[model samples]
Target: MISKDPRKGGLAGRVTKLSNSEQQNNPLHGVRLDAILEELVAKLGWEELGKKINIRCFNYDPSIKSSLAFLRKTPWAREKVEQLYLRTTKKGRK
Candidate 1:
C-alpha cells in the first residue's frame, strides 16, 4: 500500500526532474552563486568584506539575485566582489 503522508517526498522526484531541465541546457551544469558566496564568507569575515565592498546587498541583507543584478550594472562593485573573492581564497591557502 502507498503511504498517505503529504510530506512523504511525494513530488521530490518529479521536481528534481523539472529542476534538472535547465542544467541539461547549460554547458556549466550546476554553477551556484550561494556556494561561491559561502566560500568567500568562510575565508573572509562578513564585516571585513562587506565594508570593503560597500554595496547594499553585501553590506545589508544580501541575496544572490539582488547582488547579481547590482553587480551587473555596477562595474566598480563587481570588481570589489571579484577582488574580495580572490583575496579571501588566497588568504585561506596561507
Candidate 2:
C-alpha cells in the first residue's frame, strides 16, 4: 500500500528507504568507479589487474582517466572490475 502523501513516505520515499537499507550490506554501495580503480591499482598494480581481468585498458597504456572512461562505457568490463574489488576488499578484511 502506497501512501498518498509524500510527507508521509509515499512510493518514492519508500524506495529511497529500501535502497538505503540495502546498501548497508553492499560492498560497493558508497564507492565510486574511479575510487575503485585507484584502490585496485594501488593494491594490485596495472599488470596484475590486466592479468586478472584481461581488459585492454589495464594492460596497455593504463591511466586512471582512460580506465574510468572505458569501464563506464563497457558494462561487462565494469562488472569484472567491481567483482575484483569486492573480492580484494573481502580478502583484505580477513
For candidate 2, lDDT tens digit of each residue in 1-94? 1235656554542322345666676667768999999999999999999999998899999999999999989878998999889889873353
Candidate 1 runs further than 4 Å off = 1-36, 91-94
- The candidate maximizing lDDT is 2
Best-fitting candidate, scored by TM-score: 2
**Which lDDT tens digits does candidate 1 get at residues 1-94?**
1234467757333323335666565432353445556666666656666777766887787766777788767767766766566565543244
| Superposition error at 84 for model 1 (Å) | 1.3
Candidate 2 residue pairs in clash (backbone atoms < 3 Å): none
Per-residue lDDT, model 1, residue 40, is 65
Q: What number of backbone clashes does candidate 2 have, counting pairs of residues 3 or more apart or in separate chains?
A: 0
**Model 1 clash tally, residue pairs:** 0
